[model samples]
Target: MDSLSARSSPPPAATSPFSNPKPVELLKKVIFAWVQETGLPASICVRVHGKSFDLHRSPLISRSGYFKKALRASNAVELHQEFPGGPEAFEMAALFAYGSRLPLDPFNVAALRCAAELLEMTEDHGSGNLCEAADLYLNQVVLQSWDDTLIVLQTCHTLLPMAEELLIVSRCVESLAFMACMEILDPEQKRGRPVLPLRTFSDRPWDPEAVKELAGHDLWIKDLIALPFNFFARIIRSLRRQGMKEKYVSPVVVFYANKWVLSKKTHKFWEQEDGADHAANTNDKVSAILQAIVELLPIRSQDPDRNAEIVPVTFYFALLSMALSLNLSDGIRVNLQHCVACLLHLARVDDFLLPENRVLEDVSFSRELKTMEEIVTIRVAFKSAENAEVVAKLWDLYLCRVAGDPKLGTDRFMQLIHTVPVADRETHDHLYKAINAYLSAHPRLCNEDKARLCSSISCQKLSQEACIQAVLDELMPLRLIIQALFVQQLHTQRALKDCSESFRYMQCGVFSGSIPSSTCQLPKSQSPYDPEETTPVPLEDHLVQRSEHSEVEYESTRFRMQALEQELASLKHSLRRRNPFGQVSDCIGSLRWSSQRKYTNRMLKVFRRMSMLGKSKSKIKQRASASGSLACRSKSLNEMYDC
Candidate 1:
């Protein structure tokens, strides 16, 4: 009865029966067979790299929009299409289009992805597009074993616009970036590790080849820079958005951002002479870069300290570096100044937290000094006397932080302090206190260090006092000396103003080279203190009025004129020597010119170089001393042997 019931159930649905066929499945099989050249006659001929491929037109048109459009516009039996990739890539795409099992491995996945994207194909079995399938395979399977990540990145970069259009490059970039920061697990660690290990920039995957390859692409990185501001911001922002476990997003962002900035700076386009067009273009680029940086800045204000630490130090520094390099307009510059200042502050904090990062040590120091120089320049340009106090505070903060580093010692701290020009009393006092506080905090600082630092303070005080006193002393002495000299000159002028015509004529005749004789007739003045002064009469009246004593009077008047002239010359010389205020003002003007921000920065750089040279010399001297000691020991041993 059971057998009868089973037989009555439509013969168990006739498993694997061919009577009612699946036409679509059968068609796929026929297409795969056609690709292998084992089924229906090929209707369309496709040539890739001079190799003719026999393929079906219906399947190619159905699977690939690129092919559909190409064949629709052509009437030829054979179609010629260009594929930039290898022949193997096209072969994989052709087989993939026919519903054949596409063999995806590390060796061919990237190439297949490129080809699939180029051909605009979709998978036969899955709902996913072929480009997406290749992307998944490349990232999940192939990238794990693939060693040449840079080469793959280069390939993707070459086809950036197309790859981006296909929505496949993102995964490729993410995978590569993940690998760049992936921690290398030990054998034991690997055994207990999760399926996907998490990492950050702290893991520090240092691959020299990767760095070299990235540097090689620096010239072509303009593709990244040319991306619209939103796209560029999205690229950086998305790195951190991937999951909480991934802290490495910032490192790769910084690395690429730095490269992008450097590339744009050195690009041939910006090297052109500035004009209306160039300025407009430059402004556009500056705007784009500024917007991108603003987007990358930390948004959280809950914890100020952690906010900066959230992003790697290099990211902030890269932004700051780019900011300094850009020719931002005054309006933009003013708005972004705070942003730059915050970055510099954050960078210093990072350096403090991670002092062992020798890679960033010199860069941090150079950047810090450059930032100070820029701030000072801007302040000076504004010429706001009130800002001087702010500038002094800033310098104090910088100096305190620098002195806090045990390696720098008190000497370098004092050296930096000496570079500051004389400031107002209040500013100087604040700076002094800041320095003292910094020194007091140093547990290892010795008495000699304290004494030396104290000496720097005392020297500053004494120098400032001396400058003030010099200005005051010169001013007072100059005024007094000029007043005394003017009084003596006033008496002489009164005597001259009171002289009558005959006396003046006798004096003039003797002084004038045209006169043959020194003697002449003269008349005495009524009073030396006369309120009204009169000009001398002509020589005839004088000659006739006092002929008897004319010779004596002429000699006396001539002597008086000579004495007055001598006194007048002395007065002029004295006045010049006594005008100390003018001299001091000129000196102050010269000092301002000499102590400009640019000059001060140059001097600081020169001082740094000299300090480096001095250290090198000291090292050489120590080496020499050690070698001498060894030589002396050898000599003693030889002497002992001889004895």
Candidate 2:
């Protein structure tokens, strides 16, 4: 009897090797043991995507409204509908129904939430159901943390209709938009800890500090790029609706495009693969995405103070290239072209050299050419000479690169060349180079075609080196070479005539004593007409002498004018003092004042002409120096021609 009592008397209060198990732990163990039991077959068979799961009906029906409703009809149940989160998520739900711990994290949280919703796990079914628990975890933890939110959002892609039906996608997108705006709009708000008194979305002035903060902390942008394009577009639209500045929003678009749309591997695959339904479907999806991105761009922002370029010119070119490849709508193409033309001055030469799409090679090239034409037309309409010149240089280099393509025809090439006005370019060196490239590439072209190509090149605008090169080029027609030589001779003659006139003016000035002899002296040995013997004067010396002489003359004339003014003032004072109410003094004072005004006006005109003449002489001197070099080069070319 004592031994029996010892075995049953709580073992003399001795501790077991393990501590006492908590109630929750014990419950988990019992539920897991029951689930693992093979002694009794599962009460229900749940089918998901051809896979079946044997689950007990008691725990499932108790915890899930969906299970309870389905199991009411029979003991054995077969699910014929699609399941959110797949079998793994369904298993997790089943384990939770059996009083097992449901592990909630960013990776599985989104799927579990959708699955719980589909299974109708809610407060009505149980006190703390999977749906409510998931909602708590997502709102309190996942959505609050930026990185976790991105992770969960990525998982939502697989659980579509239900995820959308449950507003998980919308919640994630709105959270992202809110956080992004908070980051850029009010940087003082710390991450993961949202504060109150949120800034309202109004038309506020540009904030440089916020932009700086955004530039420094762009990790959010990197996190967002991995999200599917649909979610990304929603976030961008949310940002826009929240009145986020374009400067803050555009970079996100660019980074996303760089990853998904502009990747060479992806673009090449899209271009090369054909005749497959999957490929066609993918093309359609990508086209829609691209169109959405284009529409989301801030190209239409009409804020007058928003002067900065929100979208880069290069990215616009990229979009245009993709648009051409996909054969997007005319409206989209036209809008893109307009944006590009408006910002054409900001484009680089490489921007125009779009990657060739071999599938639509001709169509793409022609469309690109049309874009160029549109840019030129818009720029020329503005009548901004500076922008015109920039466009001209860009087109010239672009033409040089494309001229080597064997398929580029003369008509198309000439059409591109004529897009820029002839007067826009100050020098045709780049144009000549482009034309030479074309001629070299198409060696079999007839003389008429060559002349037509060369006709756009103005001989007068060609630099000295370009002129020499043109004269020596064997591809050049005889008529062009002769025209080039004749133009050079005419330039030389004009320069010599100007120089002779300047010398004669200087000599006359010195003889008339208008200019000091020492400053205006000309060398007796130098004759401007004799080009062979004439030596070019250093421009710096002439400028220095002219400046010094002008200063001296101005100072002397100023001194005389000041003395005359003082004398006039004294005479007027004496006339007022000596002849009070005397009409004669008044008449004399008025006459003197009129004469002084006329004399000052005449002197001002004379000084203006002198300054003008000095400027003209300097310009003539520059022309003369340039013409001397051209004359030497021309002589060599002439001798070569004779040979």
Candidate 3:
């Protein structure tokens, strides 16, 4: 136990004058030389003093058998609040050994454990001024015992939830400063001489049952906010060294980052009880983090592949930027905004280097995208009770009535529209378009999506059926716009008497409850073209609704058209075959006569039925019409006709 007593031999491999060896070897040498009969070296004594000093503060005996057992894999427990430091120190040594990628030398094995202990003390334990402490021992730390590092890392695993809080607070700078030391000074988790800060949040799909799972592993908020800067530094250094020259490697990295980015995109910064605390991140702190992300963004961006197979891969840097700087303090929101703006810029960098991809490109995504997007989604709306009220505000900017007028003010929509730069228009359009395209081209957002985007609905009773009722909610605005346009265009035409046949058709189609020809311009083509768009197209298909996932739109439109055409053809055939005269007049006359008396009777029956429908439409109308003149009669006549 004496500082001057040498107990163990230095393990196998020696540092070659040639290639770089591991840090654990050095650690072993330190331990072998330090526990000597003579006086300890200045550096060796200093390093041991720090790791051992905590022993005095903590009650655990340094030489306890329990502590020794923790050094081995036979027992590992870092998740609990009370993991022993001696065992924890052993875990660190093991991790450092693996990471340093050197042969295990028993003499420096203690050094590796010392490194792990240093990192845990700073990152998880608030052990000391982690950077200064780790830096003091960095010269003596081992780098070979990385597997051992995992053992140590496994002990610090519960840091995930704490990382979540740090992310939310937008204390990303502090988070980076916190982890930066861990990455470098620790010599275990740290690799490649990374000087910049780095925080990693990894949650694999599976975990030991009844133990811990990554599925629900919420990251420390600080880590989340610091993710942008930390991830960027980590990725740039780690990936650049790993050879981004590998064709798909960059893409994969991009994919993971994109998931985190989009997930943060949807997070409502204001949702937390302490949400306001993070408001500070809105300022310069966020800006600095954003600047870091921008500095690391990749240069050439393109997915030349047809499928856009790993499309999200392109978003890695952006995702990291997003994940970081997430914990925006009230002061940091500006910084977060600036960071977001930079991310948006990064996402849109290439603008256009190739023909736009229009097909429903499909790729199997890891949960990263879903996870980040969920964060983005949740943040966008439900971050606070206040956010819930403002969510429908999207209608103010995006929803349009009849492809022309937005129900929300035009100025408002235009304001929002202007916010999207021309360079990003295509990507933003492609994203939503691609989603709808995927859904429409493949399946609806779900199986019930069939019920969502059919583009055509069969009019059953045309009454208030749930589906029908929903349709009216959507189409009534459309109808209002159509009616407005009809009225506007009519001024240029003539009166009802002088209007052309086309005018009558338009009017009748609308009033008679027949689906109107798509105001979106119907195409003359009878057959589906393989080059057909996935989204609904106008007359010539110049990317009409490509912004809505061209694939899905195309599929929906194609299906609806096919169905409608078949029905129209059958009706025509029946008319022609039955009449022999190639006339609809005979059929029309018979139908008219059969319906005249019955239609009038049905009108009365409907009025009686409405009494049970919980409405007083008739009474209201009657009350108003009681004093009317020609208008009243005409109104009554129209109602009768509808019956």
Candidate 4:
């Protein structure tokens, strides 16, 4: 045979070129000279993805089984179908077939491998084929290095089923998983120890020590962010199988989702800028990414042993927001919603204020409200009082924010308020403020709606200051003001009734001779009620001083009760005569309830102190006067009641 025919002939099966390397430089020079000669033109044409290559059929058929079979029927072949790595990869294969060295690196190795497989360039056709050469380089060089494995795995995204069938993706994932698990389990690895030589395709030099020092335990996590979601999930599963803890795995998952999924430009509910088909396509892609991320997330384990570190509540909210914006599967949406609801107490008011793209104006708050309802129900079921209060307060603040939107209707506003159970709120201060905010914003709301909105607020739960403000509020409905007034009256009446009973009990204790008379004479300057009197009194004189103080408080309470009766009577008459729609500030301005409240509080304090002072002596003459004082106070209370 001629030198060309001998060089191009397939070597014997036992003597592969990979085992005993051949010097092909002279043959390459001869082939180049032959190709340049004008008298000897190329014999065949190969077309791929609109690009054409004219070449001699001898070298192509000898190197590639696919070409050897195709050229049997004709001299020209048209590859109109999609190629594995596009035209660039096929160019490399063609160059390799021509006895030229192929440039193999982590970035292009996976694609070249798939392209070689597509061309059926196996050892059956030649001594050492492109497919075998690519596989050897990938296993020995690419998978052995930390950074190269990631680069090759990323390249595998463009080479789908071919790369998958060649097990290139699985090999890269296994390598990454093993490295990550080692970094987590081995303390030496955690301290920035380089496991393999740091070599990468990029021009930028990486200092493993610096990265380990800066990223600490999360160095592997930071490196894995460039991987596509499908391969990323595979790596995560492999890591889990290797007994890697979820605490280390969760942050990277969250980071990946944030980088790829949440950062995408989502279609707004009201936007039709993109055509329906384009929007639908984008939605489907985003939905797939989101679902994959949710699946890779660690299931919130109830078992303490299995429980790992939790992903941030903010990320869950963000995921849920994105999920809602797209037309996602119900299962994925529900999973995200449940995750958010579980950690709802850790959420902030701004978390619920989802972006405009996610929130439909027609159902502005329905999704959030539904999540809150779940939280409320869970908290109530578990009897988690502290968390219940937290959720309640959070909802109240959120309500205050949304209440100002004139678009928020009464039913929705009321739904938000009532979503939290009545028992969860320790005080109605927040609820009352939220209601006031809603009423102020929607001034055109009819009286019945206003009344219904305010009805959720319990007058009994209002602080004394809030009650006073509510009474003076002109926007308050007439019935609510009356209820506030009635609550105030009940408080005052209870205080007076207790004061009168204490005085009568003490007078009885004295008249029944339960104490000695000698201890009843207290000096006038050392009364316990005097704030400035620091001098200590003997136990008996303290008792007599308490008796005197109680008698004085009884007289004061009796007079206050009479004043309250007159004011209440006046308020009732005013309500009956005045227009029901009139402002309450006009009627409440004349009442001195602020001062009356102060005095009533002071009298109650005196009564409480007198009770703790112990039953003791008063002289018979003083006791008779005390009895007369009690009788006169009791008579005044009865007369006021009758009036």
Candidate 5:
């Protein structure tokens, strides 16, 4: 044969039924046409939905008819002979889609969901396309279905291609989409739901009614509800997984039953027992979140991006829900937000804040921090593929609440701060710039409009402790309080520590700024003496004779301390003992209530005293060190390297 002819001649073809001899026939027989003709499964979903909607007209076998049509049309049965998870899935999906919707027939939903899941493991060389179509249908109706929210969440025995797809898509969600859908869920719309500022995520100047109409849609309340679903799912899942259903279920159930106590609709019922009601609300909120994390997302090595973006999204919603449902403060909000930041870091696939992004280490703190530079350069509009505030919030919350516990007090105060690769100079510098700008402008977070102010600033976690301590530098007053409440609230039922590193909000309550004197609630109702600012107790030298005879001389102040400690010990004992009422008041009282106001004050006093002592010691040390020659300073500077 001629070389050209030999080259043109096709190589020995593989043994197959349709090795086309004609080019024209090959085009017609190609898989493209088959795919085009089969089309997407979206139509199948709409058709099934329509048929199912006609209650009296639709037959039980309508789904089978559609499945049969799909099978015949696509030759899916033949395809499944070589594909994966195909034919049986086609049948089960139809049933699940319809079953999940009809509230009266959950068994059908259960049957369909499980049956379809069996096809997942069939491994019958099912067509990826067919399986994908089936998965997409199920995920849209089932995973995101509000009607069968609990069922879909609790019965997470299998992972379909669609759920994986959803997870993938969720990793790239935009803030606009989150805000668009989330704002619609007014916790106030339903009693016991969270009542947060759904409109704006920013503390600067967000309008509570920015997208009021949009927030009121059914699309906003998804099956894996960001708030409602998460809270319940967290509680149920964790308890069930831990096999502690009976142990903690009753108290939580009672708290839930007293939902009436939470509803502002029945505010009068709790008016006299606000503290008790608040405590109950707080504990229930915790239980709800525990149920969600433990139950909703099964224990799987989730995609880093998905975990980074989606985990924190769910958590922020949980935090928001806890804040609204139970009214938390800035201290709690800081802690929760901090915890979120830690989880996000754990979930990140890449150092989102990279060396290129790190302006500080790149050049040292040359009049600017590195991380801040990146922030300034990074565009953070409502939309951006590169944007990840949900992730950032998670990290920020971590730094604030769990990272550095100053009370470990010494070297550890900077542990978390250092453990987290300090934000590069750019980011740090950028933060400084923002801070300076804010301070220069005398920036105010609250608005004159009552609802606007309430919506914009969450006072729940923005207590003096959170701010002055500088734990939550990114958090504002309102956001901080809400964050803190979630921590305090969630901890009562289930510790955030039990959650995986990717989900736990560890340093969530770290506050920024100084803990002002007014941070404590002054007892307006029972102040027997004026609040003391400075100075120590006066020694009555002239009363030496009286002290020699009167054992009751130190009565009042000593009595106050004993009374406070007794009250606190009793409260802790109650919490340890599990109060008969089952409220978490005991936990609250232990954390906040003390008889010796002076004793608590003294702890603050000790901090101040230590501050003075350290300053004096440092001054003396500095003077003594100065005794070194100026030439030594030059050598030390050379070793340090120039900034």
Candidate 6:
């Protein structure tokens, strides 16, 4: 009975050896206190950047794989391991290994992450992964400032191996891309400028004052140009995908792409085995890089207006440089060469001032060609050899022989004329001779057209007025009336410059249906005591009382002003509506032609001509003629008006 009672008592609650174990926080405190305050014996020594840290061997080996292998490999009193991140980074890493919270601040985070990667300190022991902790600090702290993040990313690119190990490069790119996307979708951001506003990562609304402060510092585009090629490519591609326009992005892309190509081509003399091999290697590399970059770049829109807008003059020069140097694939080379020619064409259209333009500052570009023939050759190549012959014929008939209407090729022609410096005697002589040869080949061209074309092509010794006169004299069977009209219009234009204010007033009167009486008259209150001074009269209420002679003079002036305006309007209309021929076509038709399409099959050809003429004459006002056949009369007054 006593044994059963004793068994039921559970052997007096046997003492548990594991009872009252130290709390984790208290235990860590005690260990740290012992390490910091007490003279505790440390079994290992870690040397970093010539500095030694005396640490416990057990903790070092348990927490770091590096220490474990390093210590096991040697039984010496101290274990010295190589850490690349210097002493400070090693100290931060060591603290992390000691079960202490990491000092993952912005200033030290990048260094610490690099050290962790170098030391293989990536284990998770409830404290956290040091690499991840550093990254979090990077994102939350360092990346809060755009400049800081950009600098870090650029640094990471330079330190390729360390960055890849820590994953800083990719994460930095991601952060920039996200910010770019935010800017793209932000409604308040300006349409063409992707200026990102400053804000915290907490997703707070951007402050107006902060934006104002940032305006002085809004130059991310310039910084973007300085990024490593691959990183720059990714950021630009990502930005474009979010909604940036191709025109805005294409110039920079081309610039950097050309720059990158040039950079890669910079080979050491010893690196190349032979010219052929070097060329082949360069060609292959260029093709690969261009293809990859092209895939990531923004595609130009189908809108011709947007495409036609002028890029920086440097774009053409850069592209031309690429064409002359890099042995790109046939498709890419042809396309790029065509772009170079097209840009030259566009530059001419924009009246690109070569002397003033920055692109001409490049010595390589300026020295590439010394002859006008070279410029013409580039243009001809742009049209392709097969098309060049026919294209020349088309231009001669429409642009030269007719009345000097500027066709699409006009800009390219003008660009060719001005690309050479006036001081370059040899080149200018070559250019002058080339122009004369061109003019002499096309004899049927009108005097005015010849005069205009020669005027556009600058000569070294010949004054512009003298050149025009020489070309005009050389033209065959000049129309005296047309020449007289051209001179008269020139004189009228000179006179109109002086009468600009009056012309403007007259224009306003025409639109308003009444001229303001005050426009031409002095106030009656000049004496400061006139009877009309107290009466505040509205402009519409005012009536003038003057002598008959003064009235007659005023009437004559008004009539003269009206006639001058009419003549100017007619001159402007003529200049604006001329076809490539500089002459209006013979068959002017109306909407009546479309309604009368059901006319007999005999008149189908006539109807088609009428339809074609209707489309051409859409903007011109139709006038009835009293004499001659339809074709003859159309050629007479209409051709005169069209030019």
Q: In order, what lDDT does every prediction score? A: 0.44, 0.64, 0.30, 0.63, 0.31, 0.45
- lDDT of candidate 3 vs native? 0.30
TM-score of 4: 0.68
RMSD of 2: 22.3
lDDT of 3 by residue, 28-103 (tens): 5544444363353222111221243111111121222233344345222243333223333343343332222234
TM-score of each: 0.38, 0.63, 0.25, 0.68, 0.21, 0.44
RMSD of each: 29.0, 22.3, 23.1, 12.0, 30.2, 21.2
Writing each residue's lDDT as its tens digit, candidate 5 over 86-183 gives: 32232334333333222212112333333333334222323332234434444455434333333333333232344334442231122212332333
Question: Which of 2 and 6 is the better model by lDDT?
Answer: 2
Off by over 4 Å in 4: 1-30, 33-63, 71-81, 86-103, 126-128, 186-219, 264-284, 299-309, 327-329, 354-386, 405-416, 442-451, 486-539, 542-550, 578-643
307-411, model 2: which lDDT tens digit per residue?
A: 124445666777778788788998888787777777777677767734466455652266676676776676678676656788888888887877776677899
Model 2 scores worst on lDDT over the 10 consecutive residues at: 193-202
In the range 530-635, model 1's lDDT, one tens digit per residue, is 3364764555444434333544553444444345345434433433342334553211112344333333343233323323333333223211211232234324
**What's the C-alpha lDDT at position 218 in model 6?**
30
Q: How does model 2 fare in lDDT?
A: 0.64
lDDT of 6 by residue, 1-643 (tens): 1111112211211122112223234434645675786567666666666667666766666666676677876634232344444565666666676667754443455666777776666654334667667767787776665555665675564355777766787777766766655544556654554232211311322122332333233344545655666888877776676666565555455445544453433433313744657767656655566656655533333432244352333334443445445544556544544444443433321221122233434321332332223544555654334334332322222222212212213334455454433333222223344454445555554445555555543332433343333323333112221332333333333333334334344445535758665553545652223465685554332322222233354344334434544553453344235455666422112112442232222133322333333332211111111112323433343345433
List the candidates ranked by lDDT, beginning with the highest. 2, 4, 6, 1, 5, 3
Question: Which prediction has more favorable lDDT, 1 or 3?
Answer: 1
The number of clashing residue pairs in each candidate reads 2, 0, 106, 0, 94, 0
C-alpha-based local distance difference test score of model 6: 0.45
Return whichever of 3 and 6 wins on TM-score: 6
Model 4, residue pairs in steric clash: none
